[model samples]
Target: MRGDRVTNEGTVPSDSRRFCLYFAHIELAQKVQAGREAKRTLHEAGVAIKKQIIANTKSNKSERHKHLDELEQDLKILENELKEKEELKRQAEIPENAAKERHQKLWKVEKRAMQDLISRNNQMREMFADLDTNGDSLISIDELQKHRELDTNPENEFTVEEVRSILGSDSIDLNKFNTTVFDQLSNSYGKLLEPTRPTPEPTPLAEPSIDSITTQPSSLEIPTDEEDLRTHTRSSYKNEDDSEDDYEEYNHRGSSSIATSLEHEKHIHDSIAPEYDDETKRLIQIADEARNRYHEVGEKLLSIKRQIDDSKKQSSVDTGLHDEYAAIIDQCFDYEEREYTYRICMFKTANQIPKGGGSEVTIGYWDSWCGPKDNKYLKMKYSNGATCWNGPPRSLIVTLQCGTEQKLTDVREPSRCEYAMIFETPLACDETIATTSAHLDHVEF
Candidate 1:
């Protein structure tokens, strides 16, 4: 059967085949035309339909005006909804930005607050460390009890309530309780319990002024009484009588010689007075005043020296107390500038002065150390030193140390109105034979 179909093509059904071909051609042609019409319609429309629909819905004069009005109402509703949605979106974005800003501000504030807290904690720790007498990490109740006992008056023992009140709440920060409070308590107790040093009243010096001296002429004027006059007359009469006897004995006394002698005596008196010029008189008055002042100063110095000598004697007798001070002075003091009489005591005092100036003209001392007795060993002498321009004065304390040579190591003006200097002197060096031996032992073999 397969071979017979391959040989005869007329065996195919013509009516069905013709009908299928005709339908297929017609469908193809219709499809091609529909595609062209769709393309043309899209090109020609150019969004006009959308515009027309919008216009029709919006227009009042049209057959479907009522329906267009209904659509317009719907569109208005949709637009209102869209606006609400956009506002909601904006509100949501606002919160996000606000939240970010708030977070940044909060972070900075929190960071600073934490740092402040840490600083306060460190300060509290330091306070605690200062208070911890035993260097232990914790303050014991026994120690606190002992302190309470010491603080409480013997007549009025501390009650539990009082102790609790002083300690504050049980939840109090133990770290905050330091020796400062105890120290303050101790100071208060000392003030109440211990005897205080009596303040010495300053000795009022008899400062007799120049005006006082002028007012009291009797204090100044030398006495020229009848006794003095009588004594002078007797001496002069006796000398004249002796001279007359000699003249009588030697009758040829030269007249020129006598005249010359009188002239020479007058010249000597004139030289002594020098016609009393204003400058010379003023200088004489000054010298007199200076002499008086010098006498007063000498008396004062004698008194001071006696007091110092007495004190030294007393100190030598008090071996226990005075020995320490003596040892300290021995260790610390230094001398320099033997030619200019400059002396410096390290950690104690320094003084300098010109040659032949004596203690009165000395430049004065500068004390660097503050001792237990609060005894000041120096004076500033602001008025006495060399003056400075637009400033008070240029003053210095030459600090001394152990050295082989007398030399100035450094000079500094720490403030606008102050100066300091470091000096070296052989006197400060360890000159003992033992010290030298020790130094030799330390040296390389």
Candidate 2:
């Protein structure tokens, strides 16, 4: 104690620290037990006073009646005092119990965090082992950069120098500073990490009752565009008389009933043909010319359409590409699954046609091609077509692979109101790319 500035010099040693903590814990436990005992004493004292009062209530009244009131007052006072002590005990324990519960919850959280760290640590160890394949306990820069997937950002992929900087050397020791290695690996290659998804159990495919969309025999030929068809029809009927104008109007209304057209023709010949007096002969001649021209032009237009089809097909073959050539449109692919034949029309829609002669139902309409442009195979989506009984609007994903002919390989409804079809089509072929790539490879050293 120099100059009255007295200071304690003894410091606790490391080996005795545990004992000191244990002693403090014991003291806390003793204090808690003492508080509990005090509350119990107060409760017992109140119970004894209650029993004494009850015993005095039935005793000889002449001797103790004067003290009976005093005894009753004392009992009430004791009860009140006991209640106050109990309340005090509860108030004292509340913060302690709350703190205990909070500590328990925090411990659980920390435990889980530690477990996750252990898991991540083990994963890192395995990755390092794989990267250090040479058994030198060090991963070289070349080996590290070989996995370009390690670059989390594709736009700013790691250069060799960046990788070396991250490694802190030309090579990284697998056993040294594991946490640092884990962090660096995570920062660079975490996106390449594959996460597992929980797969659902397979469910049986459902079959729906068929509904009719059409009655005519299904034709495989591509339908002409409306603009082209309109042009052809206008040119073909330009020379027809006014009498034929009504028929053209009927046709333009999209009537497919041959019976109706025939009936109208009969009406013209029977009713209208007899109205003209002396001009009947000339009108008859004119009607005959118009009829002849109509049939001739119809035949010529059909022949010309067929020729155009043949030329487009030939051009597709010459170019050695099908779907990309613009000439292979409106093609149909039929896939039979269970009891239904799914007919998917390219650039149009898909139909669920029953095999046992039921109505054809529209399942989906062509939305667009669904993947990257340069991909050899095609993924097309048909959407907003049919309505399911208890589900959303039906949709189909049609996957097309190159083949010699058009046909379906597989059909499945993998989810409710959603269909998947794998089909083969000559239109999917890209022979030009395939052949040139192969030839170039042969010419290389």
Pick by TM-score: which candidate is best? 2
Per-prediction TM-score, please? 0.19, 0.28
- The Cα error of candidate 1 at residue 5, in Å, is 86
**Candidate 1: 10-residue stretch with minimal lDDT:** 255-264
Best prediction by lDDT: 2
lDDT of 2 by residue, 1-445 (tens): 2223323865434545555666777676667666655544444443344334334433533333444445455555655555555555555455444433333332332233333433444455556656665767678888787767666565787688866766777887744424345556754653324323322112221111011211223221211444543353344334324224534443344312112101123223233322222223344455455555555555554554555554444334322222142333466767767788888876678999988897887889867667467762467788997899988989998886655555789888899889998866545544343332111111111
Q: How well does candidate 2 score on lDDT at residue 390?
A: 81
In order, the Cα lDDT scores of the candidates are 0.38, 0.52
Cα RMSDs, all models = 56.4, 56.8
Off by over 4 Å in 1: 1-241, 252-325, 328-343, 346-390, 393-411, 421-445
Predicted structure 1: clash tally: 1
Give model 1's TM-score versus the native structure: 0.19
